[model samples]
Target: MMRDQAESLRNMVKKNRSVDFQVISITSGKGGVGKTSFTVNLAYILQKMGKNVLILDADLALANVDIVLNEKPKYNLLHLLTGEKNINEIIWSSKYGIKFIPAASGFEELANLPKEQQMFILNSLQDIYYSFDIMLIDTSAGISESVINFCLAADKTVVVTTPDPTAVADSYAICRIISNYNTGNMELGLVVNMTDNEKEAERIYNATNNVIRKFSGKTIKYYGCIRKDEKLSKSIRERFVLTSRYPNSKYSQDLEIVAKAILEGNLPEKKENFWRRILNNWINLKFD
Candidate 1:
């Protein structure tokens, strides 16, 4: 890890960097809906839109964002937890200039940290959080504490689901959890991935919102759907981003539309800055 370079970033972040950062957690009710893929591609698009974007790989168990991007981070959250790396040291950037922090399965060990180490973490990350216009958290599937905490903390959470019945049910489950837990008017958006057509995706989005309103008394915004393209699976297997490998594919084109909506739609009332909320992990709650 280049301590000098990372240390310089820490110093630079404090020179009047605004805290108006948007923390959006892209999560799903279940796995296999292409949630991480969407997060990675969206980061690419957001950066291309001239926004400083960072993807926080919050998938605790099966983190494949690195695999999807074809870039392996030298240090990760585990290293920071173990005092082997600082918060800035763990961040890795793709060749495409997409920055991300990969979380190892071993980050499960964070629940048992001592006070000194916990404070060390909070102090270290405060400088780095403002370095991005947006921070995209690719949360793990299901209603795990990590997933719920991230969703609850974010200014917005976009739940990605497919038109499948089971996926729709799980999407409702996630919406319910966030609705019950969130204290503010945190925006919730829906994206139907892998659909064959927009009509099917819209139908699924409406059905999912109907269930949310009936049970949770809240509704989610409909971000446009991303249809599955033939090149999607091929790019994944080849460890290349769909946007870079096949920019003309259906998936990339659909993502650009969603990215536009996300930019226009996600202006939630700001609360505590995201890093402060993360600091709460060791102070008030434990994600593990």
Candidate 2:
């Protein structure tokens, strides 16, 4: 009887506990799909839900997470890599409780970073890996070497898209590239942004997955959809997060639904720290 009681207690504990860490990459097939906006606002929503969140502006050349948050970062990963700044010095904490790490621009984002440089980043961010419940990597759009590596290395990857044909094609392109690189069952999701209605959004997702089925067996989860809302654009112009500034906006509410879907989904199996997994993926990415 005691053994059965102890077994039941263990089951209860297992059910209550979540993964210690989760790394999700917010990527797009092409630019102008509102990927960064989703990243920042989603981080805010996650923070409000009592989870510590970190946003890594991994767009390489064009880092915009800071701009979306209305923050001009004085230091980025390049500074940390050069020993010009410490880990704590470069992180920009928002008033909403999430942390932001902007990427280095210009020469620093060129091509794939050197292995040594990659290791420098891994070492520098070691502390941060333990401090946050989740790290949202806002990767640059397209299937560039670095971007592909970022998407694949993540525990979960959400491909943001619009209902436009080109956007859908581009979204499929990235999903195809990802599947080509890793033939495993990756935890991939789709977020349709800038849609006029839910049906339109679901149609885009279904069509994209239908094509993805041709070249690869992998399918993407339909997290949720965001309707086209002028408030989001206005909030960005004011350098404020839409969800934080106007929580009741349709865009914000849609994003909250997406965030809840993500949190409710099955987390991908991961056994190592995010940076370490990134380092390994970096080694595998072949630059042109």
* Location of the lowest summed lDDT over 10 successive residues in candidate 2: 9-18
Global lDDT for candidate 1? 0.78
**Backbone clashes counted, model 2:** 0
lDDT by residue for model 2 over 138-239, one digit each (tens)? 988888777777777788889999988899899988987887676433478899999999999998888888877777876778998999999988987898
Candidate 2 accuracy as lDDT: 0.78
Tens digits of lDDT, candidate 1, 1-288? 333433443444345345578889999999988888899999998988999998888774466789889887888777887788878889999998899988775455554444455345445656687777998999888877667767876888899999889998999888887887665656888999999899999998888789888987887899899997888888878878888768888999999999999889857455446544544432345323
